[model samples]
Target: MKKITIGICSIGSGVGQSVVDSCKFFREKVSLIGLGNNPLAYGAFDCDKYAIIPSYYDDQYIIEIEKIIKKHEIQILIPGHDDEALLLAKNHEKLTNIGVKVLSSPYELVLICRHKSTYAENFHEAANYFVKTYKAIDIKDEFFPLIAKPEQGFASKGIEIITTRDDLEKIEFEPGYIYQEIAVPRGQDPSYNAFIKQLRKGNNLQVSEISLQLLFDRNSDLVEHCATYNTLKGGVPIEIQPYTTTELSGFIKAITSSLKRLKAFGPINIQGRITDHGFKAFEINPRFTGITGLRAKLGFNEVEFCIFTLIYSIKIKKLKLSNKYLGIRQVASKKVLQSRVISIKKEDSVQKNILLTGSTGMIGSYLLKQLSDQGHSVSRLYTQEKELIDNKKGYSITDLKSGKINLSNFDTIVHLGFARPNSTDSEIHSSIVNSFELATQAAQSAVDQFIFISSQSVYGFTSNGKFTEDCKTNPQNNYARAKVTVEDHIKSITKLSNETRFTVLRLASVIAPFDSNLSHEAYSSMIVSLLKNKTITLSTPNRLISKIDFHDAVDAIDHFTNYSSSSVYEVVNIAPNKNFSLLETMKTVAQELGKTEDMILTESIENEEPNNLVISAEKAEQQYDWKSKTSLNKTAKYFKKHLGY
Candidate 1:
């Protein structure tokens, strides 16, 4: 594959280090050239090849940048700061002609986004139903302590509140600025006049965005995080504050309908004032505000979203993250806030918002039994409809691209369809994406839990001895990658307190009475070879194979009821204890089936020092009150009836 060249630019202050770092994590073999002085000092850039240019207006800006770009034949340029983005937008076409790509929208769009005054003015006119009147009050108005900000410029640069004429004189008066009426509070609490804004442009309200900006007469200081101490009095700077669950669905639905009309090109932050009439629009931040960072974690990733929109004009619903799923974010802080806690107010019902793939598969069929037994209603996605019985069960292999859903009126989606290595790549990708896409669509149905049946294919071999859920994974092939993709998407979308859970059962090689790998089901392969006096090779001498019976797998699925919000159970190796050798395993089955040794060939492939996995299911047992009760030998007895040995 050809190497992708990149130029990284940060604005003057408080660059988007996190966004840049995240980009760097995915883009390898990137020729990363930096634009800005002291960028290295911030310790954000860690590219394979890099150079630094001075300030945006510095003489060396063109000289140094061009040199690095030409040297590396740079193709894509991603800005880390708003100011750098502004400059690049103006010269966007010029850069494009010079074989450089600016990942931003047009100049006019950039202006519309950057100008804070324009947002307030435009929203004042546009926000008739959702927002109240937005007036650009005079900077020198008689209004005591007016909230004021420059119409344009970067993040938190020239923001202040005007309490007196003296405070106004300290700041320079500029055109296209807003002097808004400050919200007064009756109580002494800081969040007394707390407000949440839902930007409504002609009725299409996409989201009810709430930002808690601190007020000190004359836009004192822009605190990045905590908007206020007594957040009830003012507003909390927390991203996507947990709204009352009762009002959430209706509120979000209203916002979604409102924003569909106001087609916008860039980031928009609307100030909401719920007056005597209704939600009155106060101000609008035209550009991608810091709130973009907050809302993105709700699974939207707006930074990523804007990049695509700016380049391709594609409007992506930020990857549909949920606050309903349990989320615990631990940040290093000197101020010790109260420790995080998850206390569910309402009792979560079983099988609400359910999407269960492999609904027809062996383990899936068994899981269906337990789910039904527990009074949980489930929706299934089956691979094939073989018999008359499947008709009543809603057998479906729906088309994912067209979004033709089978049964998405579900609350929990249990995905079990994954293409194996024997299947082609497209087939594998299709099955994985289909399973997830089905679940993703089901999550749209207010589903709370997304349970996927993933194999322990991720742990190709556990060499550092025994493995736990926390052990690092080293997937050797496509199967592990597919499972990881689904898991990642689930976590990103599932929110805290949605009662939405993402549980993966990283089962061991499961063998039932019907499995192809069953010790008895396909013994003919080794039996024929043994009858021909062929030497049987066993490479994993003195090594262990993690094993699980079908019943044990079903038990694990039943255990998701008491799922933890904090723990992301990625790999629940649903394996039984005791790793028997190929010879020992065959013998165990043979004695039960009353088969002779002549029917089996114990191939010893010699000591390759095989790497095997044995996971600690301590958490599963402790938290879910679950334990594997069936032994491999006992389960193998079912082969007597099913397998024609």
Candidate 2:
């Protein structure tokens, strides 16, 4: 269990107040801290204590929140309002350090979604295919006794019940708010299934049993009212009208298909009201809330997934449901990191069993998780699997050399042993070459479709627009040359009627969460400099490079093994399309750390005359439907809080 620090930023508002009540979930799962002046909040939850911040816009909000994050040793901040959600996304990794995982989208998405008018336009464009709508707000007249809300407001803050134009005037008529057509009263509509069906069908995804409770403080006494499913006798109270599981599956798939383009990797809350025929969605939340935890308890754990990915560096392949109905009651956990390796995870009989080499390396470890999550029986190639019989992950290389390893039991193989194609040192190259030689032998025995993790540097230094799989190989360095040698060797073996096919994945420099990787260390160095108010020097002056998040890179290897095994005998590059010069990347690192950009100097590195290199993944996408999702900006921030610059 991971202990979390969750600060409710605007407890004065109803949504903020619910957060305090939500501490029932946060009691131990997350430490609840209030950041507003209102004691009138917390309609249902309780907390150990609350810290009243000056204001939401106060510059000191970040300063004080940072303090609470450190004090509680928290790993996640579950904001109560939309504003805080925006703030969380912008400062995810910043808050991520000091044990804070803020629930929000990537800042880029937030910027595009925060403005209602703009979002309405873009949402139509982005989701128009599934929704087939011209503009969401324009459809308000089609259905009424409807609700109207601020495009970016939260907790019914600027929400209005529009019986007429006069009611809209009560909320001061904001430009960002949009009047949405409401669902027909619980017994009157059927078309709602169109949207609900799309959302329930997805890979490892669980659609929420949406429940909307509206509170009215009429006169003095507060009353709770449920409208969506209030008319149903035994159905769960819901905002989205309930549909049969079979029907909603298609709905979930359609929506996610649209969201896939957005590259969503966090919690997304949709507010729906049950209509007479089905359900109507009123709003979309790109962050976590107590409701998400409710859905988690029922079947989906989006809350856990959110913290797992953004803060703990856990890559979520798909939503896992715990049918135990063991409700996810939030309790601040004590452990910051926890590992659960499925020793005997069984996949569906339909999915093929795949083989992965270098089963103990960091990249390999992650790749196994990817395959296992994708409904594949992932058996590790451990030299000591026979000795431990039960355990396949932690093994000894000595055992492998003793001829104890066997590989004749799987469908695909991922050769992911670490190889240094960029090392300037000859000894390191020889050692890396040795690892590859040994790994290939292990793979060749059992792998039907073998994939090797080769580095992008093997393409050689060049100024081509980008290096594709077809890029000319000019391995000037020993490391690159050695890789080229092995790729050629493997091709020859495959062509000679070997049962096993092979793929060589040329990977970009990967940025892992830890500073152990050079890219992260470089970024960390800049953050440290910014915090210490020191200047740093660099040498890779003008070299343009592409990078992959370590997890994403590993996932690409998995994709090759499972999906692209048929498209074999080809080399592929695993890298983001965006390329940044070494100096430019370092400066961006500085800017993200809230530092003066001038602190990092390109002049000191300009003399190095670095080579320009970027790799394209068109071939990989064409063959495996695989592409990198962790963008440059997101990768840079993973280490931002570590140095706290």
Candidate 3:
């Protein structure tokens, strides 16, 4: 059977992530793609593959998404945010023509459900149950100690309680602001004191808050209603338990039935309180609530059933409730980084399933060895899963041109591989940029850290005395330009994840064993001249050069892997403190090879180039407590042995 590809936007949001998680119910039959603005968003990492798009508000947002859909062949495109849902719904026709279904309610109904005030006016059955709503101008007959919130807001933003006439005086009433009678908590409840405390913290005070999620068919007929007793923190449900109330359920059906003409096609959430009179629904969201994951664990799994039914064109089945009452409680976590090398808390650290890319390259080979020597459980991400010794641990790009790839089950992502596109112009952007973006998408997953091996070439050809992390980048060549692109992309992705750290090390040219493919200019010249007894010409023998041994590069990586700090992002220049002139460097290598005068050098010419193009490693030395331990002489000797000189 052909895979049914589904793509979801805002995948980092709790609501969006729940939708992605639901696809796991279908296993291999479902190929999930996550799209979002932030690279560090947890949802970006959770999907089978993902792409980055502009912010939903950006004009290009839909355009970019449309491109992703056509490229990935996505059959269904699900928007996870309320505003995004509206955006997609508004563009449903255009997208549908391209063979993509916007898995959301009709645009008209989405408008009705999005604006809270509109829902009450349209559904009279639940109007009386709604708290009396009034604009500031309608305050003539309204009472004090009322609640005020955005008329069309989601997630309880801009909510305030007016306890006195004086409090009301301070508010500059806006058109979208709605005022209503405050819902007080019941004194009889066991947690009444806690509720009062929470209310004092400026939260909406209510005796009982409930979430009624109703799934509607494409024709707008109600298919299923799942209710949950909710405990909220920061407007997000932290604890939830399945509940059944006949009166509330019937009332919800009546409310939704009134909107038959809306023709909503997916999930609708009603958030309100049960009061002395009856059930009062103050707000309604036209999309999945943030507690969707909690509800799934309790057996509803609306996201799964909804997507499955829509994709298969099957009739919606009555939801089966768990025989035993199910409940879920969420815990929060925070990340902290510090100066100097520090051990990560065992509980906080992802010490298992470390993911490594660029394993086939020079530094990657040594890194693999170092990780193994330290007894780490490591996995390799390969371009081809078949090339991996353990295919289960590998991640592969579905399509490079489209930047589609699934990423999961890793603690950290070390990105070292880069596409060396031969083209030095815009023509190479697609392939080169796609590699970085795909890696970023992979890092957005649950990985705690993303380490990218950047190059000092990003600084281009700086004529300054020395460079630092603060140096302004002026990319000169296509390779350097690509590196800068990756750096910026990585920064954007990691910004979304406060708990994850992104480290970019701008390394000096590396001196490694002679391999035409991997060796830098200086190392290659030294090896070729010594082995073939050929002359090594220099424009100016007095010109100074700074190079790091391959081993030092490995050591620097080890420092980063072990160092823990409070910062979520850091960039450091990796270079030796000392510099070597061309003549001195050539003599050192020749002496190490015991070649002496056998390795010839052409006469030097007058040149105006600076003696040094090195960067300062002060920050690396102070913060990471590490620096180059090998001298240029030692590097030459090590290379001589490795090169079989």
Please tell me which predicted candidate would have the highest lDDT against the true structure.
3
- Runs in model 2 deviating more than 4 A are 1-355, 381-402, 419-446, 519-533, 604-610, 641-645
> Which window of ten consecutive residues has the lowest lDDT sum in model 2?
333-342
> lDDT per residue, candidate 2, 1-645, as tens digits?
544556666655545543444334323344455556553333212343455555546777777778766775555566666766677678777776656556555676666555544533555433422211223335444343445666666544544555544554554345665655444324333334443343233111122334432211212111211212222212222233222333234334444444445555455545554444444444556654544434433434444444554446566444434344333333331110001111234333336566555665557767777778878887655433453465645434454566565655556656565444444576456545545555466345635567777778787777648887765788767777777777777765543222355678888877665444544335444545555778876656577877677768877776666553322255678887577777777677667656777776655553565577688878777756788887656655655644453
lDDT for model 2 = 0.53
Sort every candidate by lDDT, greatest first: 3, 2, 1
* Model 3 regions more than 4 Å off: 140-142, 185-203, 206-208, 315-318, 323-325, 332-645
TM-score of 2: 0.41
Off by over 4 Å in 1: 1-354, 383-408, 495-499, 515-541, 561-571, 591-606
**Model 1: per-residue lDDT, tens digit, 312-373?**
44554534434553222223211100111212133554334345666656777777777877
TM-score of each: 0.46, 0.41, 0.53
TM-score leaderboard ranking: 3, 1, 2
Candidate 2, position 123, lDDT: 50
Q: Count the backbone clashes (under 3 Å) in each candidate.
A: 57, 39, 9
Question: Per-model C-alpha lDDT, please?
Answer: 0.50, 0.53, 0.69
Query: What global local distance difference test value does model 3 have?
Result: 0.69
Point to the candidate with the largest TM-score. Answer: 3
